[model samples]
Target: MERLITYKLPKFGFPRLLAIIGCWAYLALPSQADISLTFGTYAADKPTETVRKYRPFLSFLEIELSKALGEAVSIKMVIAKEYEHSIDQLANGEVDFSRFGPASYVLATKKNPDVEIIAMESQKGQKRFKGVIAVHEESEINDLSELAGHSFAFGDELSTIGRYLSQALLLSAGISGADLQTYEFLGRHDRVGTAVGSERFTAGALKESTFKKLVKSGVPIRELTTFDNVTKPWLASSTLAPHVVEAMRHIMLEEANASAVKQIAKHGFLEGDDADYQLVRDAMEDSQSF
Candidate 1:
């Protein structure tokens, strides 16, 4: 038989007892109250520049979240190599939060129904933005109909304004990809604008902001037509804590100010619903036949 074992509590002197009590008290407290989160996105421009532009916004999120949650909050920004990569990260619950274009948000939800929309970006006080199909200033091709025989440049295959909506615009003109002499996905709005401005391609499509920026920089491009696009939607990973989601939603919807977050969504955010992207969904579905 195993020997019976018994132990007696250690007798503590005054100093030792105080130290022992203090150690027990420290161990009994919650280990950590700080909250750490990951924010994911795909770069629409140079990755370095994208990170630079977003760091401040991420810091603002941390500050606001901390204030709302009554804990130290930190958010690490993660920029994926491409759109689909970021979408996968969000849809797979690999990241705590992410911002996505309308088309990407739709694609993510299609991929993982559990993904949730937290808010929609509000630009200039409206939850709407613009995309443009542009051509060289002197190009005689004056309309979407005129793009039939010309080569074209497009932004990322997954970019909302760059690919789907722009392609839908072409389809509405009764033009199809087969009608174009050649077309390629250049993967960035600025690149599409540059390709069109340099006459490398007869035409291209990109966001209105990028088109305006390129034109202002003497890129010599002109918007042939403009199309309305819904603003981007912010998403939360399915596995994120409900309390954290609530905190994030509160900060984004009520506390965001220009001085703090003036990145792509300059005016902050508004409550978003999946139905808000119906137009983009239609465009995405329609463009699939192309």
Candidate 2:
């Protein structure tokens, strides 16, 4: 008589074998979790212009961040024909992150609550800059109040120093919207400076950096005056993954700490948070009051 043979299959049947194989396959795949970061900057120059042309005055934060992240990063230069269009792109997540002036950041955040404040440029222990209005030496405009009822020029309506800050300053001086007979957005800061210099506008407002550059380029400063100083220059963006954000912070700090980066960025951007932007946001609120 043949002995009854005992045959025991493994506890895991074919289904279990398939499950094990799937798990192993998943583990072997490459992780695409690393963020695909995109960055943009306000183009104070022409859209067609190469960013390399103004490398001296331009911020290289994007390049620095790309190096720090240990991954590929794309930097898109934006020359917004209208401030609204730029803000709309950012709100819809067409752009992952950006470095915006105070006014532009406010407009973007108003549309998308997901944007986050990551960092800002600072000097003398302050993270603020202002809008300065000026014109050619020949122009008679002397003060913010004097701009009323005159042809006013702005760089970009979304510009913190160009439009919002300048407008806020005008309002503070009791200049009402109806007081201005004409307003123009020249699109670029250089154009704003040139227009004011060429007598195209009675006065114009721009970031101090741009103003300084124009002056350096031989635009006479005698033509311009500080019509208003409403907000500071701040950097901001939409929220990113914690690890990604940390990676960014680490890169900035490390780069800044190195003497070489200081040469590239002119100055290192300081660590910043939502609170650092509060003052900027408050100034923006004040701007709306006008």
Candidate 3:
């Protein structure tokens, strides 16, 4: 005959069982806050226009990030009145992530050591992009040397291509700020292009992409010369969760997502690090006036 003895199961108090259930519930809840991506006014367009231009790409990023992270994500267009403000937003945690021109990233790193470069923009399959000095197609000014004594326009003073690289090129040609009859900051690349195209300014400096785009759109301007390449970067606040950052990096590098990236006027994105922007730091240190 089988043994008749049977063991009794342990029982927990009501309070203990409730505690266990509560712990399980906590584990099942979502673990992250919504993400915020901030961008500066890189063009002359109004804030609404800037938002409109970026909406498609931002929407794509939002959807992908949410899907990957299992949490909601959102874009917060900071629309910085000045380029420096964008850097400030990233450094101070006003935004979780941001896209910075090379010089701005360098300056932001200086201001806030917590700034990190995670990815860079690529266009035409090249990770590097150049700055350009532009003038009216019919302008008599034919060379950087001729820019002396002529009124000049610049985009944001903190702009890498629009101001710093442009300043460096001018310095190489012996045209210092004092050499210009006058110089003004128009606050955006498109404004600089429009100002130069209309002959409102003798010359201006802007990103090669912006210059080319303006020309393609029938703006009457020509590139006077090109400057050294600057590595454009997408930066994240160090305070961001590691997983969130990795998710963004992954999305950016995914070849299948190239179409989404193209909405931002880029061929794609590449892994980037702070060291990649050392040249920008060197350029900024060398040209402080801009």
- Considering every candidate listed, which one attains the maximal lDDT? 1
Evaluated with TM-score, which candidate comes out highest? 1
* TM-score of structure candidate 1: 0.88
- Superposed Cα deviation of residue 266, candidate 2 (Å): 2.0
lDDT of 3 at 25: 97
TM-score of each: 0.88, 0.72, 0.82
lDDT of each: 0.88, 0.64, 0.80
Estimate, for each residue in 1-290, the C-alpha lDDT of model 3 and write its tens digit.
89799888579899998999999999999876566555443434567777777779878988999999988887656667777777777888777777777888888888889887768987566667778889999998888999888999988878887777778778878888999999998887889999999999999988776788899999999988887765678888877788888898899889989888888756788778777777777777767753
Candidate 2: C-alpha RMSD to true structure equals 7.7
* Candidates 1 and 2 compared by lDDT, better number: 1
- After superposing candidate 1 on the true structure, give the runs of residues whose Cα lies further than 4 Å from its correct spot: 1-33, 255-259
Candidates' RMSD to native: 6.6, 7.7, 7.7
For model 1, how does the per-residue alpha-carbon lDDT over 1-290 read when each residue is reduced to its tens digit? 89999999888899999998999999999876489899999989889988887888788888888888889998888999899999999999889999889999999998999888888888778878899989999988877888888899989999889899988889999989999999999998899999998899999989998888888999999979899999988899999998888877877777535556565467878899989999999999889866
- The full ranking of all candidates by TM-score, starting with the best, is 1, 3, 2
